[model samples]
Target: MARSLKNPKKRKNKGSKKGGGASSSSIPSLPTKVWQPGVDKLEEGEELQCDPSAYNSLHAFHIGWPCLSFDILHDQLGLIRTGFPQTVYCIAGTQAEKAPWNYIGVFKLSKISGKRRDLVPKRHDDDGDGDDDMDSESSSDDEEEGGEGESQPPVLQLHKVAHEGGVNRIRAMAQNPHICASWADTGRVQIWDLSADLNALAESEADVSTGGSTLLSRAPLIKFGGHKDEGYALDWSPLVSGRLLSGDCKNCIYLWEPSSSATWNVDPSPFIGHTASVEDLQWSPTEPDVFASCSVDWTIAIWDARRGKSPAAVIKAHKADVNVISWNRLASCMIASGSDDGTFSIHDLRQLQGDSRVAHFEYHKLPITSIEWSPHEPSTLAVSSADNQLTIWDLSLEKDEEEEAEFKAQIKEKVDVPEDLPPQLLFVHQGQKDLKELHWHGQIPGMLMSTAADGFNILMPSNIENTLPSENS
Candidate 1:
C-alpha cells in the first residue's frame, strides 16, 4: 500500500474519486463555545429507546467508574461465531487509596441471546449469600431504572479482573478474541488470557474473572518493556495474526514480532519519527504491510512495517495536536483524523497538495477523542468528544458540479474559506458524561456502542441505513 512517491499511484476508489459530498465540509458548525441543542421539536410520547428486536437503541449508566479503553468484537464475517455470546470488554477505573484503581470487565449484553448458564458464574454460588440479597439488589435496580417493554433495561452479566494502576487501553486479538492486550498507567503492557475463565463460564462453570473483584492476572505471556512512559494506544493487526502495535507517552512506537523469539521480541529501536507523543495507530484494512499514526506533533504519518525506521509519507495534518486517526475500513486511499482543536478532517491520499484539505470538520464543541467509519457503511462515521457528545455524520453527499468547479478554482487560486460544514448531518447524541469511545457493530450497521465516564451506551439509529454515494458529484 506504500505508493512510490514519484509516480504517486492512485487506487481507483469510487469514494476518493467522487471527492466529499454535496453540502459543505464540516456539518452545521458551532461558532459558539457551549453546545445546547434545543429539543423542543421532540413529540411528547416519543421514546429514545429502540425496540428489543431492533439493534438500534440507547443504553446509558448514571453512576460508576469511567471506561478509558475498550474493544467491541465486530464479527465482520461472523467467522468468530461461537457458542459464546458476543461481549464487550472494557478497562475502567475508580478512585483508590494511592492512585486510580483500574479493572478490566466483560459484559454480556442480554440482547445477544444465548445460553448463559455456562457463560456466567452464578453470583449466589460465589458468595453463598442468600437469594434474598439478590432479590433486594434486583428490586433496587428495577426501582431506579423504572421502565418496561422496549425501554426494559438490558440484563448485564459482568465479570471483572482488577489491575494495578489505570488501564489506559485494551485491544482484543482478532486471531483469538479471548486473548487481549492491555496497556497500564504503570508503564506495563500485559496480555490477559481469558481462555479458561471465559470458556468455563460458557460451559456453565463458575468462572468469575475479567469482570470481578479478584486479581486474576495471568502469567506474563507478553509485555513490551520499551514503553517507559504512559502506554495509551495498542492495536493488534487484523491482517497479520498476532503481530501487535503499541504507542507510548514518550513519543515512541513499538512493533512486536512474535516469531523473533519464544519470548515476545519487539524491534529494539522505536519507530523514530513523530516529535510528539504518538496519539493513535491504525492499519489499512486493505494494506497488510502498511499502517498510519497520528501524533501531538500535528501530523499523520504512514509507515511500512517492513521498513520500520521511518514513515513512508508524512502529512502536516492539522493545526493542533491530532488525538486520533482512522484509516477508512473499506477504502484504501481515504483516512480521517480527530484533533485537540475541536476538529476532525477527511483526506484523499491521492491529492497531495500541501495543507490542502478535502473535508475539514470544525463543528464539535470539544476536542474529538475517537472516530471510526461504520463497518457496515464506510461512508458514515461516529465521533465521540471530550465534551460528552456523540455524533454520526454521512460523508457521501455530492456537490453541484458547477458550484464544485467554482470552489476548486478558488482553491487553485489559493483563496481562503472562513468556515466548513458537513454534507449530511445524520444524528447527534448528548446527555451523557465524559464520552471517550464509539464504534458500530459489524453486523448491525445502524447500531453504535460508546463508553463514557460513568457507563457504556449502545446507540441504535431509529430507522435509517446509510445511502451509498453517487458515482458522480
Candidate 2:
C-alpha cells in the first residue's frame, strides 16, 4: 500500500516526442532572506540551552508489540490525555515462553506542578475577588504554619475487563458509540460498560482482577458466539447500536444483535459469507448494509447484511492471499485492500458492476500488511508493508487537465538540479523488519501508529508538526 509518488515529479516534454527540459530563463531565483527564528542567530559551534523546566512530564510506553488495541479517546485530542484518567487494554500474541497473553493495566498521569516545585515559583493571593473574611483567616493560618505544601498532577488508571482464556491473538476490539467496549475472542464476543469505570481505578490501589473474579463482579453485558474457529476481527455496526459483526478464521462472518433476555443472549445467524480464512473485515461507514472482508483465499468479497447465501460481489483481486481490506468512509463505492503479493487495489463497487476492472494499484515491493484511510480526509490512505515502511496516497489528485499542467510544471522545476530529490520514503521502523499491524488513531486523522518486530512507532502526516524534536535541540 505504499504511495506511488516515491520520487519527485519529473518534467514532461512539450514539442519533442519525449518530454523536454525547461528553458534556463524559466527557472525561478532563490529567495535572498529565508526566515529562521529564535536560536537561528547562534553559530553552528555555539551551545544553545533549553529551559528544562518547560519540558512535558507525560510519557507513553507500549507493553509489547501491540497486536489489537484501540485508543479510548476520539481523534479530536492527541495521545490519550497524558496521564489523564484512562485505561489501556490489549491482547498480545503468544511469545516463546507464554501461552496466549492478555494484559489490562491502569496508568495515571502525574501532575507536573508538584514534581517541579523547585523549578517553579509560587505566589500568594493578596488581591482576592471575594472571601475577604476567609482571606484574613488564611493569612493567620499561613503565619502560624509558615511552610509550603506541594500538589501532584493527575494520573490515569487502568483496569482489566476480565475474560476466560485471556484474549486470543486474532480478535478485534471496538468501542461502540453508545459507550460500550466490545471484544471478540476465541468463540465469543463480550461487551463491557466502560462508562462506570472511567476514573474509578484512579481512586483504588488494589490490583485489578481477571477471569471468574471479574465475571462475578462485572459480568459481560452481552455475549455472542457461533463461530467454530478463532474470531479474527469484529466491528460494531455503525448504523446499529446493539448490533455487531464478527469474522472468524474459518471463513465465516456473523452478525449479532443483543437480546432483551436476562442473559443478553445474541442471535448468531444474521449474516455470513467468505470462502477461506477471513483475515480482516470492515463495516462500511457510509452504507451500513454493505461490508467487506478479505481472506487467505486471494479474494475480496462484499456482503449485504440483509441477504444470507452468497456475497453481494466477489472480486478475485490479488495474485496472492488478501490480508486486509478497508472501505472508504466518505465514498460508499470505493474500497481498498492489501495482499501477500506486495500490492494494493482501489476498487469502485459501482464500476465493478460492468465489464471494466476498476482502478487498482501495485506499489509495495513486499507483502502489503495493512491499509487504513484518513479518518478526516477520505481521499487519503495510509498503507504499511513488510518492508518496514508506511506510505500515504492522495487519491483526490486529478488525472486530467490540472494533472497535465502540474506535470509540465514539475519538469520545468527540476531542470536546474543535477540530481533530483529522492522519493518520500519514510522508514517507519528503520531497520528492515516486518510491520505486523498498522492503525490510524481514532482521534488523529492523519496520525497512524504501527507495530513491528522491532518496536512500536507513531507516524503523523508529513505535513503536520514533527513533535519529536531532535535530541540536540
Candidate 3:
C-alpha cells in the first residue's frame, strides 16, 4: 500500500544544568537539521522522519512469511517503460518457522503511482504563504475523498506452492523467467516451472482463493541432493536458458547442464576453488561460459564451465567474509562485491592481476546482504545492508568544489546538512528492517524492489535525475 510521510517538525533540544548552572530559559533553540543515516547519531528520544517529497513513488506490501531472497521477473510489460502507474512481477522464497510451512511465492504489484517531484515542490511550506499551505492541504483532502488516489490501492496478487524446507536462495533465468532454481535449507537444489501460477495471476479476474491453502503441493521438475551440506549460493546462467550453478557450505560448486525442457544433468565433479563456504554466485553477463563467485574465505573467483574445476583467476576481495557479488551487464568488465564488514567494492576485470579495485565504500555499518548493478544505467548500482538501509550510488559521480558550494547555498536556509557525506551517494532508503535482498527491475528504469524481515518495498526516488526519458526522446 502507498504510505504517507508526515511533515517533520523541528526538534528542540532543551538545555540542562552545566558546571556554571546555566538556566534552561536562556538557551535558544538550535537550527533544524537534516538527519544523515550513517553519519548522524540519533539522541535517546529522537526518531527518523521520512520526507515524502524525496520520492517520486513509494509502496509497501507483505507476504505471510519473511522472504530471504527474491528475483524481479522480466515481464510482458514493455521495456524502457517511462510512464507512471507501473506494474511489476516478482518471485520469492520464504523463510517460514517450519519446513513444511514454507512455500514459493509468486506475486504481482500494480498501479504504483504518486506525485512527480517536478510537478509538486515541497508541500510543507508554500513560500512563506500560510493560506497557500492551507489551500494545498484542502485540495489534497478533496482528492482523497473523491475516490481518486486512494480508491484503487496498489493491488497485490499472490500464489504459493508448498515446499519441504526454507529457501536459502532463489533465481529466475533471464531468458525465461518462468523457469526458476531454488536452494533449500534441506541441502537440496530444485528446479520449478511457475508458468501455471504466473499465468493465473496475470488474469484480470484471478481467483485469490484458488491459491495459498487451496493449492496442492507440487513436486519440483528436477531435484538434486548431491551436495553434502546445505548451501545459499545459486544462479542461472544469463547466457544459457537452463544452465545453472550451485555451491554449498563445504566449498563445493556443482554445474547443472540442461538435458531437456524439464530435466538437467548434474555433473558429479564439483568446481575446485574457494576454501570456505561459497556465499554467492553471479553468471557473467557477457560471457557464455564464465561466472563469478564470492566466499567466506574473503576472495572472489572467476571460472569457466569448460575449463575444468579450477578458477581462471581469483582476486583477494575483502577483509571479512565476502557475502555477495554483482556483475555489471552494461559494463561487463566491472564487478561489485559486498562483504560481512559492511564494505562494498567495485573492480575492473581487465586489470585483475594488479590493483584492480576501482572504488570501495564503507558507509554501511553492518554486513552487506545484497548488491546489484543497474541494468539500465552502467554507472549506477544499489546496495542493501543488515543495517536496515538501502543505498544507491553512481560510480561516475565526483566531488566538485564549485557545485558543492552552490548546492549548499541553495538549501542552507531550509536544511542543515553535514559536509562529510560522500558526494556519490545519490539516495538513502530507510524504514525497512533487516533487509535481506534487493533487485532492480530489468524493464523499468530506476524501479527497485527489496525484501526484508518485515515485508517488501517498491520505490522510485525523485532525486535520481533523468531516470525517465522524455516523450519525444
Candidate 4:
C-alpha cells in the first residue's frame, strides 16, 4: 500500500533521512571562497585588483543556476563578524548538479570599527564624538551626500555549511543571529543553532573545512521534511519569534507554526495565488502578518498571513517573470519589484489597482536581477542587472525642504500622492561583472554592498559620511 510522504511529522522515516548512514551519505560537498584547485572558477576576465572596499566572492562558488531557481533578494546576503562573529550567507536553489552535491558559500568579515579611519572620507562631526563610525542618522541633511571616500576593504573570509541538494532558501532569525532556518531542495525544512559568542557561534578553526579561518555549522540542529518539490523562498517573521513562511516551485506557500521547541508543524493547506513558482517572499516591516510575494507569473501579490485562502491585493506586476521584490523600510506604502525584462517598478500598496505603478525604471538594457531601497533614505535606491551594471537612484525631483515635508506628510496623513516624477540617477559603480545583487548597509548611511557572478563588493560614496539622525531614529 502506498501512502503520502508529504508531511513527515507523523510518519516514521518518512520525508527525511533523519540520522545514520543515509543522512551522512547525503551531506553535500560544500564550497567556500578560498578558490580551490578544481572547486572554484574565476569569472572570465576577472583579475585581482587591490580594491580597498571590495571583498572576495562569497557567493555560491560552484553551484550554477537551477532550472526553477529561487533568486536571492529579500532573504538578505553577506556575512559580518561582530564580537559574536555574525554574518549572512544565502542558499542557492534546486537539486545538485554534476559537481557532485549542492553547495552553499558564506563570506565572513571581521567587525573592525575604527580600522578604516584613514580610508573613509572625512565627515563633519556635529556631536563631537571625535570619530565617525559610519552609523550616522538619516535625515534631510544627508540626502545630498555621496560616496567620496576610499572603500574600507573588509577583512573577508569564507566558511561552509553542508546539506543535501543545495539550500533552496535561508532565513536568519531576526531576534537571534545564532538561529537560522533553511529550506532544502530534498524536501526538508531545517533549523540551525549557531553559537552565541564569537568563539561559540561556530565550530573551532580545525573544522574550518573550506580553509582559511572558518566558523560554520557542520550539520543542522534538527531538520524535517514537509513540502513536496524543490523549495524556493522562506521568510522569518519580523514580529513573531518562531513563525516562518516557505514557498515552493508548485506555487504552494506553507505556514510553519512552532509546535514545540524543536519541531514545527506545517499547516496542511498552502497559500495559493501565483500560477507559477513563487520566486521571493518578504515579511512586511510595519504589519506583523502582512507579507508580499513575486512570482514567475508576472505578478506581485500582498497577503495577510491569517487569510490564507486568497491574496489581499494583487498587482499585474511585470511584463516578464517578476525576479524579485522588496518593501521599503521607511515608507510603509512604497514597494519595489524587478523583472526578467530589464525593468523595475515602484508601487504604493495603498493603490494596488491595475495602473498603480508609482514609478517605472528601464535604465538597464539587461534584465534587472536585484533592487534595494535604502533603509536609511526613503527616496534612495540601488539596482543591479544581468549586464554587470550597478546604479544608485535618487527617487526625488523636488527640492530638499519641500521633499522632506512632502514625505513626512505622506507618511503621517494619507494625503493624495503627487504625480510620479522620474528620479535622478545618483551614481554608477564600475569594475564588476555578472552583477546579480545589491543592498544598503543598515549601519552605514550610504554604504552599499553588491554581489555578482564574479564576486562581492562593498561600495562607498564620496559623501556617505554626512548625516544627522532622524528624530524617531
Candidate 5:
C-alpha cells in the first residue's frame, strides 16, 4: 500500500538537477532528473528539489539539543496499526556541549495523518476528467472529517530528566518500555525507571508541564562503573526479559542479568573477543542465548552465553571499523553490518565458516552511522550515514531489464532516473545533517523516525510496496 501527503510544505533542495533548462533541437527534453548526493555536484543556478508527492507524511521537529541516539519505544497501542492519524513515543539522549546541560528526553508525537498518493498511478492518456473530479471531492470530504486534527499541526509532548553526563548511547528494555539504560560519557552506565514520567505523559492530554520539566536528580536504580573506558555499544535481548550486553572501548563486553525488579547482577568476568573497541551489539531474535558484536578490529563475532567468554565463531567482516550491526528479526540467520567506510553487508550466519556474506553495497560516500531491518518487512532495511542521507533498501528486489525499460518509458517524461542507480534502492531521504541513528516504528508498518545534528524527522514514504498479513492468517 502506498501513502500520500496532506498539506505538504514546500522545501528547497541545496543542489538538485534542474528540471527546466534550455536544450538544443537535437536533444530530447528530460523534465525531471534523479540526483545522487555525493556523486552529483550542483551546477550554478541549480537548486535541490523536494518532490512533495513522494511523501505520505513528513514532519520535522527539534528538542533544544541534538541527540546522537534514540529508541522508538514499544507502546501499549495495538501491535499492528495501519490507521492514521497516528501517535508514537521515543526516548533520546543528548549531545550537549556541556555535560551539565545534557538531559534525557522522552517524546510523544501525535496527530500524524495524511492522504497517500495512488499506489498504481492513473494513466496519463486516460480520458477520465469527470471521474477524477468526483474522486478528488470524495477524498476531500474524507480528509475534512477524519483528518480535522491533522490541520492543527502534529503535537509534541516532551518529558525530560537530568543526567550526570552526556549520554553516549541509550536503549529501552523490549519487555518494559519504562525501564531504560544509558551509557554516559563519564564512563558509567545508569539504569532509570521512568514509570512515573511515562504515566504523567500518558494521563495528560495537554502540553506537558515544564514547571517541573527538569526532573529532580533522583538516584538511578543501579549505577555501574565496571568498564575501564566508556563505549557506545548497547542492547537488550528481546527474547529474554531484562537481559543486556554493554561493550566498551577497551574491547570487553559485559552481560547483565535481571537479579530483581530494580537491580541487575553484572558479572565481573567480561566476554572478551574483539581485539579493538567494540562498536555495536545485537542479540539474536530466535535464540536467546546467541548474540553478535562488531568492532574497530574489523571483525564480527558470534557468541553463545553458556559457552563462557570465547566467541562461537568470528568473521573478518570489513576493511574499516565495523561500526554497527542489525540482526534480522524475521530471518534468524541473516545479519547486517555497517562499517566506518560507507559500505554495508548482509551475512548468513549459517555459512559463517565458508563465504558467509550474502551481499555487499558501497553506496554511501561517508561512514555508515546506523542501520536496522524493518520490523514488518523481512527483506527491507534502513541505513543512516554521516553524509546526511537516510536510505531504504529492499534486498529482495533484483534488476530486470524489461521492467526497467518499461518503467523508464512510463516516467521518462516525469523523471530522468539514472541508469547506474542500483535497482534495489527504494528511497533516499535528505535534509537532516550528520544523521546519527534511525529506527522503524514497531507498531506502524511504514513509519520511520531519525535523529541527527539538526533534529528529528518522522516520515512515511509514499511509494513503498507494503504487504500486510490477513487477520485470519
Candidate 6:
C-alpha cells in the first residue's frame, strides 16, 4: 500500500467512483422543499411581507404639493412609444412655513424606469491651429466687439425653474398636436417646445428691467387686459397659431393676436358677452370658427368668431353657476358643461331646440370643479369635484340598462362569468377632502391624472400591457 500510494496517478482503485467522486446511484438525495402560494412566513409581532414583484406592478402614490390647485399636461409622443407612458407635466404652488406663496415648480412624473435628468450644454474648448483658427477667433472677437455681427448669439434653451412665488393655476394649449403652451399665475405664459424640451419651459424676459443672463427667456406673444381679478381661463384658437382667448373675473373675455406692425403691439381684441365673472372658456376642437364660454350667471354661451354681440345660443340648462365647459373631441355637435349645483349636462348643438338635454350626469356630492372628455375614447368622460373624487363615465353605457336582460346576457358572454357578478369599479385616489382638477392623458385614453387639495395622483387602466391585442386572437 505504501508503494502504491507513491504511484497513485498510474493506478485506479476498484471502489473508486465513476466520476472520481461518490457514485450518483449511491448518493442520498435530500427532500425538496416546495413553497405553497399564499403561505405567510413571519416572526412574532412582525408585519406580513407582501410580494415585492406584485407591488412593483402596481404604480400608485401621492406626490404632495401645497396650495392645492395644479394642472397636468399629458405627453402625447411618449404614449405612442411606450404602452401607456405615464409622463405628465405638473405645475404646483410652493409654500414655506408662514412665508407667502411665491414659488412655482414644474415636475415631470418619474416613471418606473428612473427619474428624469436634464441635459445641459457644455462649453467647447478650442486648440490653436493655422490661419483658419486665427481667422475664426478674429471674426468671433469682432462680433463681440461690435455687439452684433455675422456671428450668432448662443441659442436660448428652456430650463424648468422654480419661481420664488408659487403658481396658483395653469392653462395649457397644444400648438400642434404634439407641442404645448402653459400659462401660470406669475403673469407668464410659457410655450413649452414639446418636441425635445418637454422638461424645459421658456419664460419671456422682456419685462425685466435689470437681470443677469438666463438660459431661458419668455416673450409675451400676447398681453391681455380688462379684469382686475386674476385670469380664470385661457383657450387657443384651434384654427390660428397666434390667436388666443382668455377670460377674467370681471365678466369679460378678450381675443389676443400678435401685432401686424413693425413695432409689435400686444393689444388684444375684446369679446364681451358674460354678465357675471367668466369661469371657463373652450374653443370648439372641431369647429375653429365657433367657441363657448361659461360663467357664474348660470349660462353657457356659444359664440361666433366672425361677430360677437350676443351668443348664438344660450344654454340656460343649469340651475346654478356654470363652472366648466368642454367640447367633445369625437362629436363636433356635442358639448358638456358642469355646474356648481353638483350636476353635469351633455348638450347636442344640433338639437338645441325646445327644452332638450341630450344627457345629464348627476353623481358628485359637491360642485363639479372641472370636466374633460377622453381624447382617446369619445364616449367616455371624466369630472372632478370639490367632494374629493374623480369619476369616469361611459356615455355609451346606459345606466337604465343595468337591469336589462340583453345587457346581462352581453356581459356574461363577454366576461364568461355569472350574470350576478358585480361590475368592476375604477376608483381614483382623492387623498384630501377636495379635488381641484382632473386631466386625462391625451395619448393614452384610459389613463388619467388628478391634483387635489393634498397632492397629485395618477390612474391607469387595470391591464395596460394588453392594450392592443391581436384582432384574430
Sort order, lDDT high to low: 5, 3, 1, 4, 6, 2
lDDT per residue for candidate 6 within 329-349, as digits (tens), equals: 787777888889778999888
How does each model score on TM-score? 0.70, 0.59, 0.86, 0.64, 0.88, 0.62
Candidate 3 backbone clash number: 0
Those runs of model 4 whose alpha carbons end farther than 4 Å from true positions after fitting are 1-107, 111-153, 196-217, 222-224, 398-423, 463-465, 469-473
Query: Could you give candidate 4's per-residue lDDT for residues 299-377 as a string of tens digits?
Result: 9989997776689988998889887788887887888998888889999887775577988887676777778888778
100-183 per-residue lDDT for model 2 (tens digits):
334332222222221111121233477553323321333322221112332222232345444443343323334332134334
Model 1: runs farther than 4 Å from truth? 1-55, 61-64, 74-100, 112-148, 201-215, 260-263, 353-356, 398-423, 466-473
TM-score of 5: 0.88
- Against the correct fold, how does model 4 do in TM-score? 0.64
After superposition of all CA atoms, the RMSD between model 2 and the true structure is 16.4
Once superposed on the true structure, which residue ranges of model 3 sit more than 4 Å away at CA?
1-32, 37-41, 119-152, 205-215, 467-473
Best by TM-score: 5
Predict model 5's lDDT versus the native.
Answer: 0.79
What is the TM-score (0 to 1) of candidate 2? Answer: 0.59
Model 3 / residue 215 / CA error / Å? 4.7
lDDT of 5 by residue, 1-473 (tens): 00011111121121112111111121235466666778777676666666545666777776557777889889987778765677788888877666787778887877766554555554445565433432233354235224662434467788888888878899999999999999998889889998877887777767653234565466789999999998899999999999999999999999999999999999999999889999999999999999999999999999999999999999989999999999999998999999988999999998987989999999899899999999988999999888778889999999999988977876666666777878888888877766789999988878898877666788778777556642211
lDDT of 5 at 359: 96
Best by lDDT: 5
Q: How well does candidate 2 score on lDDT at residue 386? A: 72
**Residue 381, candidate 5: alpha-carbon lDDT:** 95
Tell how far residue 409 is off in model 4, in angstroms. 36
lDDT per residue for candidate 3 within 1-473, as digits (tens), equals: 00111111111111110011001111135434655555667676655555555665677676667778889999987767756667788888877766777889887877666544433334555376443542243445223222365424467778887877888888998888998999998999999999998897788544343124343488899999999999989999888889899999899999999999889999999997899999899899889899999999999999988899999999999999999999999999999999999999999999987977989998898899999998888999999988878889998989999999976876665567777878889888887766789999887777788877666778777666555563322
